[model samples]
Target chain A: MAKRGMLIVLSGPSGVGKGTVRKAIFDQGGNDFQYSISMTTRKPREGEVNGEDYYFVSKEEFEHNIETGQMLEYAKYVDNYYGTPLKYVNETLDRGKDVFLEIEVNGALQVRKRLPEGVFVFLTPPDLMKLKQRIINRGTEDMETINKRMTKAVEEIRMMQDYDFAVVNDKVENAVESIKTIIKSERFRVERVFPEYEEMLGDK
Target chain B: MAKRGMLIVLSGPSGVGKGTVRKAIFDQGGNDFQYSISMTTRKPREGEVNGEDYYFVSKEEFEHNIETGQMLEYAKYVDNYYGTPLKYVNETLDRGKDVFLEIEVNGALQVRKRLPEGVFVFLTPPDLMKLKQRIINRGTEDMETINKRMTKAVEEIRMMQDYDFAVVNDKVENAVESIKTIIKSERFRVERVFPEYEEMLGDK
Candidate 1:
């Protein structure tokens, strides 16, 4: 059997640009990690391929998956379901392919409870002040909503303690570079190399 | 006080190219880690700077340091004493500067005993068969000595379980790159970044 691969979860508070950094990492085309395709009940947008963009499914299918404990993590938005299929992730890892999941902090926490061995990376803003500035610059939320976001951001950033690594998203390029470093180093970690080395040494 | 820097120890079995990999990493000049200068009683050869090349010392002084428990780890080769200065390493780390140490397998084990927090990296040859070939090609040792060395190499390689990471030294440049990745990702590890992030989050 092939060696199981790492489950890399990139997550942080909202407005920390996790999605932008993840896109940059993929667009750079250096890594071979499989993007964890999310199963969603919402209709795919124009030109969106079913498997590439997401695993398009009916509401009944999504709910059945949830009841069967097949969803690694899921969230509902606008009366639609979005989730990661647990079986697909496990199969990919079993095939020695790393699975990359860019998710919200809450969803990441949920995955962590199920897979503590997974590498949870918390993408952080440079600072709280900077994060607040970014949110304010968006100019989309009302004052009350903005204040609530700021508080939520602080709370989520504090949850960085649960993460295996914390990469400050000061710049998209730098963040992508650091995440690459993490993945490379993780492959060399002792736990991953121990069995391989022992086998090479003729250990049963 | 600055955050204590990581103590990165590069070690492996004899003839595994630990020295070559370490030299490539520093010669590449991308890393800023200060090489932990060895305090030696051996006479400085041509062009060997007192501090840059080594901390040249008399036999009496080296012996005094050994008596005082001031040497981090040392090994006697021929008639010369070579070991890392405990004081310098601690002071540098306290000042937020990393210290890199390239030493023998036994010496690295000693350092691990004293400083369990250090990042011990085992630089492995591709396989034991390849390692045997390297030793045979060297052709310096008699058959009996060569057999002893091969046995010793296997024993030392088993010590990799004490290490934090095991990098395969298939190519010098690749090993150097992997070490660089390890250093970079280590700084982002939760144990190292927890304090920094907590302070950023207003922890006292």
Candidate 2:
């Protein structure tokens, strides 16, 4: 089998532009990486394709996967279950493609607990004010909701120490480039390389 | 004070083209990294500079620095003392310049003991046979000496697990690029960034 790929868990406070940065990374063709397809119980929205956007599944199927231990991490939100499926991630990694997951802090923490070997990268805005501005610009949340999100973002940013890497989302392109560099370096980590190549040096 | 710079320790088996890769990195202007000059008790060879090539110091001076803990790591070789100067390295780092030390396995291990936070990178040839060829092509060693060096190289390469990262010296430019990415990514480590900028979010 090819060498296993890195499980890179990217997390950040809300409105840190994780989605924008992720899209930029893909558009740049920075490296050979696979986006983890989340299994969600929510119905597919317009233009959303199954397995590309998410593995849209029935609520019962999602629960079954969780019970069978096929979910790396899962969370229930407003009667919908969303989670990272272990089957696809493991297969992609076995195929020698780094797996990328964009998750929230709590979900990232859960993945860390289960797989400490995964690289946990926390994304943050240049500052809290910038994060607030981003949320305001979205125009999807009310003033009260924005205030609540701002408070939550503060709490999440404060927990960055738990992450392996912290990147500032100052510009989408810069953030994408930073993450690409990180993944490239991570592939060369000693522990990750030793397992596959150590036996070849048996004469030593 | 400026942000503390990274301590990058580069090591590899002899004849792995470490010097070539190092020069390539510098030539490419990969990043702002300072080559650490060693303090040596050995008399300067022809055309070697005092502060640039090596800080050719008196045996007494070298011993005094070691006794005063001004030497980060020192090794006595053939009645000559060679070591990294703690004072110079600390000053460079405090000035926000990453210090790059190209040393052998023993010296790298010593530095790792004294400073666990240092980034230790081990460069390896694509394979043992390739390494032997590189050593033979140098034209400085006889058959017996070349054999001994090859054996030693195997031993050192086996200890690559002690390093934080490893790069295959397939091509000089590739190895240089690998190190550059590692250095770039390491600057974003959570432990390094959190202490410096976490407080900026206090008002949030």
Candidate 3:
């Protein structure tokens, strides 16, 4: 029988470069795994593709998924709906392909409650000063917004206690390598990878 | 204030090459960190030093340590006592040096319950066939003893669920590298290494 794939949830504070680190993982040829594309009611910005970047759907379609329990977890933000689809994740795992879901702490927690066997990893900046610098360096938000984000970052970092593994984003290369190592190491977890060992022995 | 060192406990079944992998970690200059030298009442074998391989002590001294609560956990086998010393491990951590202890699963579990913050890693053989072969290659025991050891090994492998991390011992180099990655990555855990940020923000 084919082995089951692992469900990995990645969460971190904003501006911690989770996107960059995740991109590096994919760029390093992690295409065998499925990157979960979330469904959102928000309109796509420039260069965003429907069903590729995100499953762009109307508010009605999003609500329909919610009603049918098709959406694993959903929440409204800035009057737009965003959620994970249970079908795609389960299907990918059934095919023995690992799945990666990048989401916020709250969403990750919700997904954990739904999929208790999921692997939860929290990424953190080296320090608060570096986190603030990264946020400001983006050149997108003003000082007031940056302060708000920093406040939120502190709260999110506190929630890191819930994660199974924590990776520090001191350097992009190091952080990406750590994440890859974590993926490989977790794959060897005896219970997850060899659950049928006892049954196999019993059959013998 | 200087950062506190992490107490890492490594455990695995016998003949999993955990000792070889651990020696590689030290040989690669990772021994700048502390390796806890366990105290044992067992008489030194050929070429073994009193304090280098182990803190060899008399049975009276070992019993005294157990009475005084100096020993973290101790077990008796073949009419000899073997155990970890709390003072050495705690002192090393207080000095800001990472302390690595290669112990059996029971000792690791005891330390985990007592320390609660120490890292626990379980090293596993590549597979059952390799594990049996490694035991046979040791040539220290008869076939009957080898079969008994393999049965014990299966029981120990079942307890892998209790470990925080698992590394497969397929190759010495790969196992050592994976363990090094785990240690380096764990150094970034927010709670263990970043408690000051919480203090700076006045959050517990």
Residue pairs clashing in model 1 are: none
For every candidate, give the share of true A-B contacts it also has.
Answer: 0.66, 0.73, 0.27
Question: What are the clashing pairs of model 3?
Answer: none
lDDT of each: 0.84, 0.83, 0.78
What's the number of clashes in each of the models? 0, 0, 0
DockQ of every model listed? 0.45, 0.48, 0.30
All candidates' chain B TM-scores are: 0.85, 0.81, 0.82
Q: lDDT per residue, candidate 1, B129-173, as tens digits?
A: 365455647676577766675676567667878898988888898
Q: Which 10 residues in a row give candidate 3 chain A its minimum summed lDDT? A: A195-204
Better of 2 and 3 by lDDT: 2
Candidate 3 per-residue C-alpha lDDT over B1-204 given as tens digits, one digit per residue, 9 for 90 to 100: 546789888888867777788888888883556888889988899999988899999999999999999987778878999999999987878878899999877788788888878777888767754554556476766778666756865786577777877777888898887777767667655567456455545531
Positional deviation of residue B172's Cα in model 2 after best superposition, in angstroms:
1.3
lDDT of 1 at B78: 95
Rank by DockQ, descending? 2, 1, 3
The 10-residue segment with the lowest total lDDT in model 2 chain B: B195-204
Ranking by lDDT: 1, 2, 3
TM-score of 3: 0.80
Better of 1 and 2 by lDDT: 1
